[model samples]
Target: MASGLCENCSQLRELTAHLRKVCREFERKIRNVFREFSECNCVRITPERSFLRTTQELPSLRLLNDDETQLLSQESLQALNKLAVSENTGLQMSAAMHYLHLSHLLKSPLPDAFMEPVMALLLSTDLDVQKTISLALVNLLVKNNVCKELVIEMGMLVPILELFQSGDSAAQCHSCACVAMLASSESNKDAIVVDGIIPLLALAKSYDPRVQQNATWALLHLTQSDGSTRILCQAGAIPVLVLLLQSSDSEVQFCSCTALCNIAAIREHHPKLLSIGGHYLLKSLLTLMLSSVQKNSAQACRCLQTLSKNVLIQEQLMELDCVLPLKALLKTSAAVWTEPAVTLLSALSAHPPNNDFLVSEGLLDEVALLLHHHRSSSAIITHSCVIITNLCSSRMGQQAVMESLCLSGLLGALLSPGLSDETLLHVTSCLNHLTTWSEWPGHPLNLSAAITAEQVSGLVKMSGQIQNSLLSCNCAAIISKLEMTEEIIGLLRPHYITMSEYLLVFLKKKDVKFQHLGIVTIFNLKKDGDFSSLLADSELEVELRKVHAQTEETRRLLQMIQPLSPSSVNP
Candidate 1:
């Protein structure tokens, strides 16, 4: 963090680090020699001036026998305490350097006493003292988490936050780094955000690259708080973070992008972030993804994933034609890109415009790839099913899915053993959508028969599982798409009681769509009269007679059903 040091100063930098780790006796001898040298000199020796003078005179060191020397002796801790508050600017610099060195070299938690000097020197006029102490606090507080509450007790965050507005760039950079560490702790999150966030939003736009980078990182950590999103958005954090998305540094882009994602994740935060040229943020993230900055690309997709949740942001994404970056990311050999890309595609597919575009570009291929490659990942499988479900609404999507390997993968995902219910719901929903214009000898009906006949025993066994509404509904839905031959009907005839029960429950659903799905599938299976007789032989008609929730569709099905035979005579 000590920038602008001369070549000799850089060499002396190693000696300065070494000087902290030497034995207590050697430290005493060095301090005595230092005081004598300072007193003997006509010019008061600043730490920087002393360094320049010492770098010339002391060129060699006999490596100390490291047998018993521990870092930072008791006398050195005493001298550090005195030097930290000394009026001499040079002494403060030396203490600040030792602050950094001791924090790094010591094996344990930094001593509690060292924080006193940190609090005292925070307001120093000397830039070196400010930068070095800020960096040291970052080591002690951020890297080690030694004094988070203690820092709050000392109110160190206030002076640290001020550095962004009032201190030099190096001070701002390290102060920003320090704030990021503080913001990561739960106890400090609310207190830090109260006074600290605005400067971070402001400092993110600083012309200094390091300042911009650290400020962006700080913003990323600040977002770990659930409350920070609104504060960040209201302070105009979005546009500035979006600008940082274009930074030449990939790390800057990654941090800014992830920060933008955290803000964008909450739906209520969308209007504030999107209303002010949010479209450009979407565009820049996509551009970075296409440019193949791998880390940036991954985070950029995450930003896209979170932003796409808002329908309005989805509209903007549709305009940007995000499918290019989506497919590019999906096709990349890296497994890391699969989940985010498909997840974004799933969210985008909810919007009809984006859905159709994704279909045209053959985004189904990516969905199929994820299904095939990441079957063990329920999230990947779930989102893949959602993409298929959404895309199936489009006729072009239907043909694309049917004509390619995607259909096989879709079926494989659906029947995948032990798939979670959330995933099973998506897979079943996709099949229901795929059958909207169901035709035999083609995509799903034949595909269903080929897959279902192989598992008819599973289907029938599943049909008895009416207690599981998803499995029962999927079985009924799959039957609706089958050829409905006597063979299929007979296969369903064994679970006669459970099938009729499933239909009755389905008919009673509040949504008319569910009622229609239930009645229509029951009517389709009525062909052989065996399954129909199972219904006719039950008390279903008597049950219907007592119900008042029947819609026109349910009534129409009953009119067709009542002609089968007499109702069951059981109690």
Candidate 2:
């Protein structure tokens, strides 16, 4: 009997030790909970502090248990609702929402039940509270996969839409973003459009630049649907967009311009945009490209590029005298404007539709002059050469090309061993365009003697530095135009290995221009019998494989040649 009693005592001792171990573990867990919760000391509430303490002290507290996360969520929701209505406590509520957001506890926080309170806070007189509540609602919807139906069921869309008209720009911006996020869902887009998104966009135009910017982004997102572009046009978005382009804020200008780009991207909407003040806006945008501020000018240039490529827009632009500003921009000291200037000039000069406009505007002589005088910097010279090449591609352009007496200057630039790869590329491309245009069936001039044996000699002297992909492509283009098979073959013989290496490297670049130029060069080179012998060289075969693969892709998507549009007159 004594032994049995001793066994029971031993079992009791073991039970006591086990209980102590469990208690210690529970205490450590509580401490950890407190540590994490306190990390966000940004939240300050007497009741919240007490609740946190209670949960920490009783590690096994029902409220602290994951199983009870839903219940705690209910309690937190009630607290938020009450605090949201209390003016003095709104900041605390915001802090709590932030903490909940950061902790990713929204899914467990009974989002559906809190929707009404959030909608109410969104209409609060306090801007800060309104912004916070709107952000929290967005977080709730995004985090919990809450449907737009849930929002509509709670009768929240109206109030949210009302927030777009709010005087507080921050609140309005957030509301627009939230609406945009909701509208992205196919289910939500139709309702958003039907519920007067168009009128709201018009209203947003008058708001501060930040609000306008956000609203434009939201409108762009909404207009991504079919038939929405027409809706936007009918709702007078174009006029507002044009006005917004004149905004001093670069961001507002960019967003507005980008919206125009999207509008133009839709083929059916192109005519509508032109009818609805697109032409005048293009002129204004071109003027902006001449802004002393670099940012403003760059934004304007991008906008013009977008509009210039559209068939309807190009025709419209060509009717006006856009060549003057374009030429002026090319000669402008702003290096940033140089590329767009060249691009515009090239586009205008290359398109048959704009050839007459360019000639009538005396653009060819101006372009030729720039080409002749701007060789101080290789980039400037190269860009000028591209412009001239574009000019020379047309009958009128060739007439001007021949009349300008600048071909000799260009050929000299290409032969100069000191020219940068970029300069050489540009000069050779210009020469190629001039030669090709001159050789056409009804051509006005001949460049056959212009690129004669002396020219080949000059080109060969720089063959070492000209081994780069860019310059090699330029050389090939020039040779193709001149049809200098033997001369090109001789140049490639000594540098087959280097040529192949550079060609392969050039094909891998992300730049489309580089790829296009490289492929064209290869195609021209292969036309010459020397290319076959060059390909026979063992070292070039692998590089040739890569080049062939890239060239095939490029050939499928041939270079697009767009004409200049009629110039828009600035009011």
Candidate 3:
């Protein structure tokens, strides 16, 4: 019995040893499967037995429960780290693609460890892999300034630009998009411009509009730098951007117009932009503004405003008949469109020639209506006031304003309580121009009917209420011209020097009639010592002698003169 029991114990021990060996072999097999699968190039693992095997199938794939998921969660980072550094090209490519996809899953930037491997993989020979990496880089860089700086710091600009220049459309699109994202950072702008990406961007703009849109947007971002405008212009960007303005796509048109608008902001580019058919750009913007898309119209108007800063361009815009379309835009019930529209008109009207054109187009009435309709919006009122002020500079403009019955609106704006000081100042100046028109020859407007005691009273109140010296001076000058009553004299007496300085400024203006009005207003003040001093300054006497010497007002000034008190005279 004892022998039989011992033999049973021995067999039990042998069974335990055999089970342990089988368990070790099974664990080793599963470990090899995972190792080989992670290193394999195939996107999906089919239970392959070897790390290098491209294709194979194995049975008994089990569904993963919570336990398996927990295990994967713990090992996923480690596995990715290993895959990133793997020597196999296939595995490295897979790692790059995975990291890009995983970038979406992670909330922050790819670990500092991962960036080097991924960026290094950018030179992958496979076009598909290259595109994938480019696309991945775009996702990483989008709205992520940290990643952008990293990419920029890693010297990715050349590869990205090469992709923009030579890659397929998809590659170029993704690459250009990356460039756009990076270019948004103020820190990245110099790096981009220094690397000479402007020509590549200009080249990319000629591609499909999709690619063109991205590249154009990049160019737009570059222009934010103070110096990029010259860079882009030198790279032949003006014609390309101007041509893009004609695109039918609203977004394309909007982006293109904004880019051109930015470039045109640099005063030096004005002539270059114009010489490249900027007038057609104005026409296209006019056409685009007709679209229901407000942004398109707004951008177009802004571009026109910038380009119109050049007086020659303003005249060109006039010659292109931009007034009618701009007028139509003013008719829009939308104030969003009205501000830029009127603002552009204001810019165009800055040039005296365009002011006459605007008057001829009946823009005075439109501007008056704008003032009347948009009394609540200070921006509209301010721009409209600028138009009125600029318009009233010319005889044609002044007549148009009076004939269109905008005089009442101008007076009302001045009288209206709580108007912006800027608007009030402009309105008052416009009124002064209207009332003084009778003094200038070839001025046919009869402002006598427009002027009234109540209007003069309103001017008095504005002069006292506003603290601006120029505004008060303008009010006093208008009153002195229209109705030199005791109250007007009191207002003018204290502001004699202010008025003199005002007159001196306009006296220097190229407008002869403006100088005539100043001389007349000052002479009408009848401060004989002041009048004599004006005649005494040799330089002033020379300029006054040139043109104002013959006017009736000059004769009146000469008549009012008396010798200065020796005490008040400069030694």
Model 1 agreement with the true structure over 172-248: per-residue lDDT tens digits: 89999988888777788788778887888888888898988888888898776778767777767777887888888
Q: What's the lDDT for all of these models?
A: 0.71, 0.62, 0.68
Candidate 3 per-residue lDDT, tens place, 1-571, comes to 4445577798998899999999999978986896676576673454222422321121111112223232224344444444445555665566565655554544554556556656666765556666777887777777362467778888878877777656488878878888889988888888888765655456445648778778878888888877776777787877777787777666777777888888877888877776745456667777877777878877788888877766766766777777776787898887888888888887877777666767888888888888777766777777877888788777567667766757766765665667777777777777776666655555445544455556656665555442475676677567556545455455445555544555565567675655655677656655545445644764555666665545667689887999688888966
Can you give the lDDT of residue 25 in candidate 2? Answer: 100
Clashes of each: 0, 8, 0
Candidate 3 lDDT for residue 279:
59
TM-score of each: 0.70, 0.52, 0.65
**Superposed Cα deviation of residue 271, candidate 2 (Å):** 2.7
The best candidate in terms of TM-score: 1
Q: Rank the candidates by lDDT, best first.
A: 1, 3, 2
RMSD of each: 10.3, 17.4, 15.5
Please tell me which model should have the higher lDDT, number 2 or number 3: 3
